[model samples]
Target: MNFALGRYFPADFPLHRLDPRAKLLGSLLIMVGVLGARDLPALGLLALGLVATAALGRLPLSLVLGGLRPFFWLFLLTFLLNAYFTPGSPGPLGTSLEGTSQGAVLTTRLALMVLTASLLTLTTSPIDLTDGIERLLKPLRKVKVPAHEVAMMMVIALRFLPLLAEEAERIKKAQMARGVDFEGGILKRLKNMVPILVPLFMSAFRKADLLSLAMEARCYRGGEGRTSFSELRFGLGDGLALATSGLLALVGTIW
Candidate 1:
């Protein structure tokens, strides 16, 4: 139940001290680079850059691998489906060789994308991320867009992702204690999940209600005149991170 989905892990590393704005923009660029990569060599370079970034951030390897555990089935499914269905020369086991290659590339691309995003969240706090999003979207406010509200919604959704996973685990345990068999066919598993899903939804709603009440009690309002306690400033580390991300993107494009 030690899921790290979009959860912040604090460390005094350079990445942790970087301005959220820099990380947000830099991460976006790196993600775009990952998605735009069309060759294995470029993808390999991108993967290397990601690993180096994680090392630079002082993030634990266990945390990175554990965060990816939830997506193992997804990775497998993506590769399987593409390998079996894509148009290519037939290979061993009645699979297309080219299709399998493409599938492997795609799966790697997806894993790199997820890892990059997870790193962003692991280094940046939820509050800083929220503020960064709000500031980034401020220009849209002139068009009557609720930038602050949107950022708040995004942050809340991210903050709850891991909590929801933990809650689902707890519910599963409770159901198992009551003799609910989660094994067997897909349909049987689906049936077993009903009890867990219902209560998890209810719990989420209850938490949302309490949160609303807490906000009301504190007289909380939108970010119209809100001031931040820690001002985000672009520093040397922030510049380096952005430069590195941009360099990766450039190399990915040309390589």
Candidate 2:
């Protein structure tokens, strides 16, 4: 199933092996900075960072664009809404003296955030990200946030999304064979999706229950006293990445 959301960088670049904590922190900082960015230059730099990271991971443009496919319509909607309704205070926000500057800010922020986050996922493995998350939520352990459990769940979900999507696709195909008209008008298509969605939901619930039982059977209690086999250690490269990200974020915020 293509839905697996595979941890699939080319595995040749130095970035691929860098500490996941570095990647996660960098991504968060970049996202915050990009979302807060109002200036075009800052956004451009953020875009460049995203592109550079993608390149560092040796990811193909096609792969990146494919991820962007689901957002094409979203982008169109954002642009139209911004261009149409935004107050033309700072000289018409649309193409020419049309939309509000606020709308433009929102649209640009959304785009930059999307680009940055996509790059993060592209470069970092799901497992590494989960581990990073558990580490990050260490503070929450004091408050009983079940951070490790949440991280495990997310890792599992990411691992399975593609598989489920594939399963949905297969179900759709089988229904189509049975004269189910799923490829019709939008409303019709959505309703037809029920056949796929119901079973998917059931499967997910069952999987969750089974996973919990299995973990309990294995004597897995919370993260308490849990030692990881793959102990994460931040190295010089991680420091460098974090420093670079911090500098960029500070610049964006200050500017």
lDDT of each: 0.88, 0.73
**Per-residue lDDT tens digits of candidate 1, residues 23-117?**
99999989888888888899999989988888988888898768888888899999999899998899978789988999998998889888888
**Candidate 2 on 73-128: residue-level lDDT in tens?**
67777867776765554453234344544555666777777666666666777777
The estimated TM-scores of all candidates read: 0.95, 0.79
Which of the numbered candidates is closest to the native, going by highest TM-score?
A: 1
Deviating ranges (above 4 Å) for candidate 2: 1-12, 89-105, 182-184, 213-219
Q: After superposition, how far is residue 252 of candidate 1 from its true place, in Å?
A: 1.9
Q: What is the C-alpha RMSD of each candidate to the true structure, in Å?
A: 1.4, 3.6
Q: Pick the candidate with the highest lDDT.
A: 1
Residue 75 of model 2: what lDDT?
A: 74
Residue pairs in clash, model 1: none
- Clash counts per candidate, in order, are 0, 8
